[model samples]
Target: MNDVESPIDLRNLKDALEWQETANVKRPWRKDFFDYYVDLIRPRSSDQCQILELGSGPGFLTQHLLSQLPNIEYTAFDFSAVMHQLAQEKLHASEKTRATYVVGSFKDAHWQNTLSQKYDFIIIHQALHELRHKRYAIEFHKTIRSLLKPNGCYLVCDHLCAPHAMQNDQLYMNKQEHLQALQQAAFKQIKIPLEIQGLCLFEMNVI
Candidate 1:
């Protein structure tokens, strides 16, 4: 069903599930990425850490994050209506979990302004390159730095697509570009051998 006639149809709930089902084999990458983040971010002496996961489709990565940091709170957000609904259903099943799901376009959402809370960690998985503006990524990076505590961390992971394939109008940030943006936003990149959903990890701290 995901291989529908139109791209719009592929964005539907059924297609989203189908796509996820097909991509299930890639969970190892996602797992590795999250593990790297958890290890690096090991919140020091904090009992109530918070995480903001961007593009939290179906809450797969979000669930793992929550399990790792049992006392931590989570705010999972996604742009797609179908994925947002799925995230709500998935997150709602947890009775004791302190997780919130928001349905809004990540491209231009007032997440920090509306929430008014800083996070110990912010994770962006398989979602960076989808942004249409490189400046947006930079702005978002700056936003994260501003919203993170002095010792807080941010993790961004995305597919290592063929270099040539990133030539489209939409600015798909390269690995170096990502690092530069993070650094410009006053973040320090920490090298780690991490992978997730075919993405390599770029962990940074807002020191």
Candidate 2:
């Protein structure tokens, strides 16, 4: 969290996770993002359900999710080893459920095979738009649907892009395109309460 430089790639994800003191500061608004996100999904998903979080930073919310839900199974994937170590320490310290952490990109070909089971609920908090390219985007959804056990819950919350590109290009998909893409993949979308910073949450039933 010092004045560390961002890694060339997500190799910094672990660093970001390990040194989250800076993350909360860098993105002060994300605290509210997590607050709104947890409030939206925690009550609906029981402990009996299986949940997966893609691009989890340090499992802070992962810890919260486990404690709030009933006998739940948790598997979180992050491409950062630093994050894996930090997450392990935090999760164990909290005495939360033993979480499965896989270290690799979401677009990796071996995901569905390694992940094995479909989730009852999948939450992507603030990490949806980081996915790289168009082909990878298509694969991302295909893999997401594969992880669903029929009508599984897909909760997504991400940035609201400005109408102009070059300036507000952090957003990978426009708000409307994001919705349309989900619908195209057969998700029944319902808009949930939004928080400050244009953070939107969608609860989609994977039918």
Candidate 3:
């Protein structure tokens, strides 16, 4: 989706389902890591306040977040329909009403046509690395900047790797690379306030 492209196949429904189980097995560490992102969320002014989660998988983190911040409206987007189905199953009946699930890629040609509103917060967890093209990292942050409300937060929790390291099926960028990409997207007040294990958490604001 950026000026430089790499061909990679996205995960299908079957792979998506399997990945959920794997993430579950690491829930103890994963939950704490994910919680770091949620902890920084500011409470919204209304019950209808919105949150957008990109690459949401089976609602693991979303359900955990809803428990902490119960009233806000939420939208979960993932490329796999099976992930949405699995997320629905994981969320409580009452909590389900607060969420809307969409199946699509943020980098898709039609992505901009689907989103109609900006969000108070946009969160991504460990999914960025799966992007086939590293250059899309820059483009996707630009997309995110436009989707955020003024002064809203964009939080990303992902693994860091050597700058030149190559990983198939993933876009691994070192800290400097990440900063450069986010800055190029015009996000302000950028900071990496937390790091746990190999995961680095980025907090940037739309000004």
Instruction: Compute the lDDT of residue 23 as modeled in candidate 2.
Output: 56
> Candidate 1 lDDT, tens digit per residue, 1-207?
111122433248888887567655745555666676667655542678878887777767776666666677888767666875665565444523588776665556665664557788888887776565566677788777777776787878776544543443344556667677777776765664674333667878765
| Strongest candidate by TM-score | 3
Quote the positional error of residue 65 for candidate 3 in Å.
Answer: 1.4
**Residue-by-residue lDDT tens digits, candidate 3, 117-179:** 999889998877656556778888888888889888998877777533333324577788888
Indicate the worst ten consecutive residues by lDDT in candidate 2.
Answer: 1-10
TM-score for candidate 2: 0.79
Residue by residue across 100-124, what tens digits does model 2's lDDT show?
8878777567666768788887888
> lDDT scores for all predictions?
0.66, 0.66, 0.76
Clashing residue pair totals per candidate (backbone < 3 A): 4, 3, 0
Q: Residue 145 in candidate 1 has what lDDT?
A: 76
Residue 127's C-alpha lDDT in candidate 3? 78
RMSD of each: 4.8, 5.1, 3.4
User: For this target, which candidate reaches the highest lDDT against the unseen true structure?
Assistant: 3
